[model samples]
Target: MNYSATAPYVWDPNFADAPDCLLSADQCVIQAQHYFVKGLIEIPVIGSDEVFSWGVWVSLSRENFSRAADLWDTPGRESEKPYFGWLTTELTIYSPTTINLKTNLHTRPVGERPLIELEPTDHPLAVEQRVGITMDRVREIAESLLHGARSESG
Candidate 1:
């Protein structure tokens, strides 16, 4: 299963036309101040080889952002250290907000999106990442997103 956010949570459509801002399929810069990168928050599926993933964005420091961009097309970029960032996408299916979660963006091979590793916290999303989620949970999330359910409780 896969879900995605097209841009950062703070993205403004007007930024698209601003000379100082940039919005692309895998990267974003708002007002040339806020840097963001798209990555995957993957969860293992219990009893299956399949994985569930959220194609989300995370805000990064200017230095980290520059470093990532410099290595964008470089082979073996996956060996580079992960960049610290804050989760910018809101996964409405989770309660108590899914924004601002701590994350580490691990760059992958040239063609793949970076991997987002959430901090090991008590948050349900983090817990699910650390442990594995069942297929039933995946279906629940899919249903929630597909039906526009506001939160997991719904």
Candidate 2:
């Protein structure tokens, strides 16, 4: 089945009420193309008052989503990191809002399955710093997005 053709855009739960600009995947086109589960998360800091933020935009093919769903219900999905294919691109930082700092991820991968390079590199957020997301949540968001989109289209 063509998942992208069926799915709608899924906004981050925290930013559901916020403007679409702050969302990482708001710019994505879900049609005959790929589908994505996107979210933004605040990086917790212990010391200073400056707020840091991170965003995750995981791109999934229809087949990949099915595989991920199976793995999600399995006991040890965590060990299989990068369970879903992701949009690999630079992390963009936007000016702070009155409430908190914001970050956006816009990745339109040129190749197939460009999993992020996760190492202790110069990147602002390390692999460990990347937010933990479950495959179950991914499926939930996609389903919600698709259902909403279908409702509107009808």
Candidate 3:
């Protein structure tokens, strides 16, 4: 399940100049991105008006923090332990521009590329996925009603 809960702190630009801590543990909700005394990961779901990208950073645990540097220094092991590293994606929208990010957007599986299940190219979302305009696809469909440009190519 998507464990999406904001921490006790509120990072409203109107209220605080920076990310501010609000509630204590128990009362605190695990936020999407914010450092805490308690170990909490900040996953960045990045995307654009015409593109989408997703990433998650595991909040460093005390046990994991110390060894994090060593593990992090090692190459060819994005799926290793001690520190769960960052994963970046190049969003391409094309002849099939829109691409499907995996169910766990941030966590791409070990040693495999995320797959996109293509449906009939009809809805803006389907078209976007089919074409490859991802980040924008999520915003356009999930939150707002934006008409997207048609494309048979990326």
lDDT of each prediction vs. the true structure? Answer: 0.95, 0.38, 0.31
TM-score sort, best first: 1, 2, 3
The TM-score measured for candidate 1 stands at: 0.95
- The CA lDDT at 107 in model 1 is 99
Name the lDDT value of residue 75 in candidate 2: 50
TM-score of each: 0.95, 0.32, 0.25
lDDT of 3 by residue, 1-154 (tens): 0122233223243433233433333122134243222222222234433334222222333444334334434545345422332111212322332223122212123333222232444744344444554444455443321122233232
Tell me the tens digit of each residue's lDDT in model 1 across 60-131: 999999999999999999999999999999998788788999999999999999999999999999999989
Residue lDDT tens for model 2, 22-62: 33322232332544544333333333443233344555666
TM-score of 3: 0.25
**Poorly placed runs, candidate 2 (over 4 Å):** 1-29, 39-55, 61-63, 88-120, 126-154
Off by over 4 Å in 1: 149-154
Best candidate, TM-score:
1
What are the RMSD figures for all models against the true structure? 2.9, 15.0, 13.6
Would you give me the overall lDDT of model 2? Answer: 0.38
